[model samples]
Target: MYIGLGIVLIVLGAILAFALNIDIPGVGDDTLGYILMAAGVLAIILSFVATRRRPAGYTTTRESQVDPATGSRVDHTDIDPR
Candidate 1:
């Protein structure tokens, strides 16, 4: 998701820097565009780093047993972190 957002920001920045000619009161279009592009690159890099640091999978367990006194069956389920 962050990667996609970064790509979008980069595209928008490129359009602003190269295609648009409108001027802002306090900021330059090209300058803002370059800033946005840099931020986008940063976001994408961070996303990749975060993904690499995350666990690959979770552990799931299921158990079943017969209660001798009650003559009934019990079921249990659990999920464990990687």
Candidate 2:
């Protein structure tokens, strides 16, 4: 989702920067375009960083054990304990 958003932002920024020529009161088209492009780049980078896979040492496992106090079966789940 983030990657897609970044691509869209980049595309929109390119259009605003190069395709159209409009004069606004306080903001210039080029400035807005540059800002959008920068934001898009940041988003793309952040998405990649956030979605990276975990290290090999990380693992998830489930085990069944009997509870000594309760004297009943119980399910235990462990994730990346180390």
Candidate 3:
């Protein structure tokens, strides 16, 4: 989600910085555009880092038992780690 948002921000910023010709009183269009572009790049990089550090969804485990009365084997399976 953040990656998509970052791409949108970068595209908007590029339009504002280079394609537009409007001039405001206190704020510069080019400056704001550059800031937005920088923010977008940062967002993308952070998103990548966060995704890389996350763990997997589930854990698997197996167990075996002996049925004393019938002298038979049994098995068990567990999905979660904890």
Q: What is candidate 1's lDDT per residue for 1-82, written digit by digit as tens?
A: 6999899989989988999987898999999889989989999999999999998889999999999999899999999988
Q: Please write out the lDDT profile of model 3 over residues 1-82, one tens digit for every residue.
A: 6999899889988988999978878999999889889889988999999988877687889999999999899999999843
TM-score for candidate 1, residues paired by index? 0.69
TM-score of 3: 0.68
Cα RMSD for candidate 3?
3.1
> Estimated TM-score per prediction?
0.69, 0.65, 0.68
- In terms of lDDT, the best-performing candidate is 1
What clash pairs does model 3 have? none
Could you tell me how far off, in angstroms, the CA of residue 4 lies in candidate 1 after the best superposition?
0.7
List ranges where model 1 is wrong by over 4 Å: 58-81
- State the lDDT of candidate 2 residue by residue for 1-82, as single tens digits: 5888898889889988999998978999988988888889999999988877434466789999999998999999889843
After TM-score superposition, the amount by which residue 72's alpha carbon in candidate 1 deviates from its true location, in angstroms, is 32
- Higher-lDDT candidate of 2 and 3: 3
lDDT of candidates 1 onward, in order: 0.92, 0.86, 0.89
TM-score winner between candidates 1 and 2: 1
